[model samples]
Target: MPTFPAQPSPANKSIALCVLFPVFFLAILVSHFTLLRLPYFWDEGGYYVPAALDFFRTGTLIPQSTVTNAHPPLPTIVMAGWWKIFGFHILATRVLVCLFAAAALLAVFRLTRTLLGEKAAWVATLLTAIYPVWFAQSTLAHADIFAAAFTLWAIALYLEPSEDRPQLKVAALFSLAALSKETAIVTPLALAIYELSLALRASRNRAVPKIPATKHLKSFAALSAPVLPLLTWYGYHRFKTGFIFGNPEFLRYNATANLSAYRIFLCLYHRIVHLTLHMNMFVAVACAIAAILMPAIAPRARLSHPVVTAISVILAANLLEFSILGGALLTRYLLPMYPLVILICVAIWQSHMARLQWFWLAGLTAVAFLAGIWINPPYAFAPEDNLTYRDMIVVHQQAIDFLQAHYPEATVLTAWPAAAEISRPDLGYTTHPYKFVAIENFSLIQIQRAASDPSGYDTALLFATKWAPPQNALSLSRHNSANDAKYFDFHLDLLPNEAAAILHGEVVWKTSRGGEWAAILHFPRIVDARLNPPR
Candidate 1:
């Protein structure tokens, strides 16, 4: 074993940071190719890749996706720049997401070290590095990784020693985070509220002592600083897209479907705590218990040093995420929180280097790794994640080449969401030709829009769903009985969508691989809504 320096002086912190950061990042960069070579999952193909292509070709900041509303444009728009250099390689595009994810990991490691101690920090970092959700999401072109990294940076900057420049940096990071995803806008405000709480606590202890007026003023400014960016972007998006949010799809999701306030809130919170507990109920429980014990640990750990301050800022961010976004429902959402928690854990280990404490640290790290953080959950999810990653770019690549050569610049309408958005949301919806209410879901509006509006464009090709498999078992809803299940459960047992039924038209393309070991199907139906799917 090559022994290394345990604790470098504050001056040498920069060198240590420089050395470890790249090593951790490269581990992911190398691991990405080794692990998998499936095509871009679903949304990466649908929303992200297309938006990147649009942004790259059009050079537009607003990367307008065909899906048009569920999320913000920053992730896709930024991906355009990467596509410029990487030249449409999924591996190369993933590297950008991976870099952001690496940044998030480094942030988590530093956060843990600051709050807890070196040992605990390492434990937390190791856990974070291997967490399946974190590992998976980092390798995909999703906004969460960027949001997470910037979120951590914002928390770090906010928690810095009461300095003006640091406050400004915090503001900038928060702004960038918000840009990455609309949900992140709530983070900074949550952070501000927490700092206010700290200020009040300190004030209570000192009636006669002069208040840290400068810090409060700075906090207010930091809190207010984001208004400019929000307003500017709001105006820009509104003017560009004829809507304030700039995406009609989000509006539809919000007004028509999507989780209600109570549901969203409950789901988000349950998601976070559950994931934490699932990773290790004890670690989650331990963190909660340790928080109550912080007053005692702070005095012993010299943690009142900058480490504690950083933890405070991150705690503020965590609260903001929980309160505003409802919770870090997913690990990617808590990427910033991971660092803060790690720092706190590290600080805790440093406070008392007892046998039990080290054992606890080991236990937590072991559990987190077992939970599969190293693979990253949010990105690299299995079949569930498949829809997000299955961009069908490989399929599309051939299609694109064929179309460009034969029917140059024609618009293509694909049946599988992967062909269009490469995301599953399309398939999730049932078109009006058949309504299987018992199925997971179907967006009537999305069906009408996609199916009805093909006449306006000269689309050359349609990449239809070649195969369908049960992603999960479906239980009948209250509104549905056995008969209702037939439509969605299988093509052979479909029901009427008004007068229409499943496979309700001429079967144009059907093959059994010429008496070999395969099956193929191509069927189209014209719906009552005038939404025709070609055979």
Candidate 2:
């Protein structure tokens, strides 16, 4: 009996909505900063921040010694510039990243408002603000959030009524999306599909003739024009490394090494299952299923409604790209997709749930809000089921503290992540107190050689984070004979270096956080034996 207007509200209400939306976001940010004091998260300290520092040091756009151009360089380049301007302390870096997150939140609200009505827009924005993955990543310098920011705003621009130079503006935004992360190449495809769908629907209404195929082709070409910069970067990369995306070693080690088809379905299933189970009281899917049957239940509110159709197409396209092509199903990769889901769910809520007298919507929405508090990186002491952001940051910081206190002047052999963090100048840790030997992979031979060199380290500190496996697991194998396999059997989530360190070196002290451990290891005898193997 009531119709929701799609056009702008009264001028006074419009002004009020704009003011309240930003105030809400500011409050969320202030609350988050007061609650959590996250260090440079796992990837930020280890990979992203280090890479950005290297670029600044070398004055190059590309990260120095980049392997897989797994991500496009723009995010790192931009972050490096930010670090240069603001200085690279953890709080500063995190605050800078939060700015992008803020922008993304605004874009989500604006887009949802355009497609759905005001009530749905507010619901969608609130959901995005509280969504665990998006919220957690907002504080760190990971590129996923940055990429999502670009993609969300680009879609918002693309959805606006066509205007003079609209093609140029949208294409530029899409180009930024791709540059932020290569996976955002899905944007053009989603846009083209939405445009085609609109044309087809118009034709069915007999409002206009079906658009010519050539016109579609021309539009697509214009949409694709901004990709030339991406192509040029690939050209440069190929020239430098003899590979388009990265060097052969990078592909062998990073790209193809851990990739598995099984992870694809696992990724899709986990997000759906986890988010629904945690946030929706398992009602999201049931509601979604019911929406699919809406035509049978209510003739007027088809699931094929245009807003639903457009957002659904984009969400589906993005999921397909990640499942088929993503190297790994990192939670970060799924962050951009969740906001779209929120939009669709809200659309369903508006069109059918209210009219059907479905009380489940109210219950599920309350569950989502309550679920927000529980939505954080697992605790440092949480079980091995998942490694939260806290787990990662605490583990690394503990390792760095142990090294600095115990072997202040010793040469340390560590995986790149620990090495990068300890070496970081912004953390206010003295990098000079310990000489660091950064190694990508662990090896007895390399350690021995480094220790034996006249100018090399006399005492070697072996530091392992959760990501690196020991190059020499021979020690773990030897101990396994004594029924110690359980000690070395790292769960699917952790690396194997801790067991190897225990077997080869005398553990002066051991420390652990979450499922990961780092120990101060002294391996004099093992180094000597390896330097002069049995004849």
Candidate 3:
């Protein structure tokens, strides 16, 4: 391994952290200012916000209002604590998540500075902050940001070169990461395997026999220590919920149903795209690939061999693991890896390009990332991947506002997150809960089922559940019955007018933005005082 610079003094490190954190926090808050007050979107409304509210209201780790997914309680605990101090508000929740994003950026800065230098650190951190997925996630109350923050800090500690490395601190951070989200255990587990491989290789060598192998063995043990806490969490969850992973449906969706070899292969391809090309990340990565072919202008800017190997192992492990694990190929799941990718690309640019060339490349890449935040790709993707999520929330809020203004007492028919939005005031959609009938989604079959009993609800609030762009090639090819049955059950949502016809209602109000849309349908019926009178 190449000799790395000495670690910063404790006092200096503290000062840098203090200065960088507020700067990063303020930048993130300003960038996400408009979105900070918006109601929770998608999974935030569906699961995370509800779970945190349950913990905040009742002090129960297992959410009473929402089905327990057996996710670790750290995020819930943190959010509940924030609510206690700040007094439960959407702004407070978003600000807290921004703090986590800032912390993650600080860790990225420190990691890149240690691996390359200060200049490289600045470029890497700046790019990571503006990356569409990371920027969008900054204000969203999700476990991924919390876990990414802790995981990046832990990786920084692990990679920092010192005579006596802080193995225990690394393990503790890894444990905290896992406690934030169970999937975060993958990082430490990946590192542990990497350490074991190093130990095995050292053992095979006669020159450095026992000492190097024993050192690596110790590192492996420490890295693996995070598993105990994670297992303990699972044990407690099983004791409480009678399931180790989660509800059967959660287990089936995230794990069991994803075990098919073909699906895994498909997911692997998608994962590659997510890591290398999603949200214009290809701009930086492609530049790095081209730069690699050029002669080094500053060979000293290259990362040490061990550092590159470790980062590569981390990226590869996450790529393969997430492909086999997550049901939905959400980009947010790979949050930590984006920083590593950026760090490598920035380092390569610093190594090969002249100062002017490096400046232009980084500038162009930043512009691309910023553009990605507003521009939707020509494929199906989670709205949360970019500002499309904000568009989604805005449209929903408008529909809800219209519903409240005209028919506050009417029973509203909608799918979750809208159902959750209208029913839960704490989710920031309304001051009071509305009567709502929930369906799975806005698909034709689901709408038909709702149509079977139009008397159940007086108003129908329909929205685009899946983000299918007009030129979505994936949607065109993926609409087949075989694909639907084997993979995701892809279904086209009925247009507001079409759905209204089926439900014997008229579209009263509708709005759309950035390919997402929402509408309210009203059904009129005569009420006979003799049969059903007002109380």
Candidate 4:
């Protein structure tokens, strides 16, 4: 086995592993179990859970009739099968996803142990398990944790010294990563670069005879051959749908080759700024400086370091992919790099900062973990921040209760999130649930259809949440104004002004909870007032 910079005593290593696993597991469990019942917020209710239900009904890989080719079908299908077996309950699905989370924690521990040392492995695993984003994402039914787990395991196996059929195992693991998420195709690319870098270092050291650059290129290409299955999947989609991935609308709105360079810079800037601001600002800034200065301060140790090289490649590939392809730039888009970010911090600490009291390192990790709680919890710190699971749960539950009590049979005008919640029979609303129309990018026309305004549906519910013009139009709305196009992917163009115009009527019921606002507007009253204006 190859030795790393830090090798703890065998007894110490065993003690660390024994202590780390249970503590990390308990942290994840305690942190996530409470949030499990927080209704399918964000993409869970909006797309994934519904797609899983659709898969259950249709028995096909393409779960949604909308067939968002934006992603491969693996996550949705897996969730669907789990839902079928376990029954479609929020806690059950969340627990299933948590199993993936546990796998990720194990992968992180093993990878760090193999490359760094047992002590570093404990630090990395604890950092990963406690890190707010990874913890929160693990609880949610998303493909990201699954992809990250598979990719981490794949890289771990790829770095391992030769065992029987190691290459084959690595190849299969990479394939699994791709199956979990399309962007995971970058895993093998990063690994290929890592391999080539090692070969180059070996040749320079006279460990092997100098080889032609073309030979190295060919070898890298061969290592990347496992990505062919991913290519074939995209090919099948193209052949069937005439669109390359699935969601042409998403591609149209988010991608542009002509402006890829510009988009790349902007996206990277956005991500970096958000990371620094929301994800433990001080620690984030410190980590960035450490990663930058590590090479200059310790060139020899930094340059040829296998783990650092692999992490750098993976991070670079992820950034380049999003920059070039340019779609709805979200924090989640950078999730594959989350583990890398934690690992980079661990590497820096292991290299030069270990002399500091051990509690200092643990203190910083604790700060990052706490920062995530505020980020993930609704109205925990930011009152108007709707970028949380709790916001949806609190607001949607109020609206659902109001509608059930008064307008039991009324058609509810809802966006995807609320629509998905109301449509479900198991939510304890009523035996016969209310009807709803699930619209995204809300508009007056959509509201009209959802309410069945002209027909006999007398009451309409406009379950409004964080809808306002961008506070930072210069940054967020640079591409388009709120009146023209959505500034962010989650925020609709239904600005306060637009919503007021549509929702002008006698308010039957209203509730404001967890930084989200909900209201039920009387359609008849609004119509009568419009027709018979009082003298």
Q: Largest lDDT belongs to which candidate?
A: 3
Can you give the TM-score per candidate against the true fold? 0.65, 0.73, 0.94, 0.78
| Candidate number with the higher lDDT (2 or 3) | 3
Q: Which tens-of-lDDT digit does each residue in 329-394 have in candidate 1?
A: 334555455545545555555555554765566566667555543222321122222222233334
Across residues 397-441, which tens digit of lDDT does each residue of candidate 4 receive?
Answer: 777777777778787656655665677654433446677645563
Between which residue pairs do clashes occur in model 3?
none
Error of 2 at 441 (Å): 8.5
Model 4 worst lDDT run, 10 consecutive residues: 377-386
**Model 4 off-target regions past 4 Å?**
1-27, 64-66, 161-165, 193-223, 235-243, 254-260, 274-277, 281-284, 287-304, 354-358, 375-387, 424-433, 437-460, 463-502, 525-535
lDDT tens digits, residue span 113-182, model 2: 7665466666678777766556667776877778888788877765553322266666777788787777
Error of 3 at 376 (Å): 1.4
Report lDDT per candidate.
0.50, 0.58, 0.86, 0.61
Lowest-scoring 10 consecutive residues by lDDT in candidate 3? 1-10
Residue 499 in candidate 3, Cα distance off native in Å: 1.0
Clash count (model 2, backbone only): 0
Instruction: Give candidate 2's error at residue 31 in angstroms.
Output: 2.8
**Candidate 2: worst-modelled 10 consecutive residues by lDDT:** 378-387
lDDT of model 1 at residue 452? 49
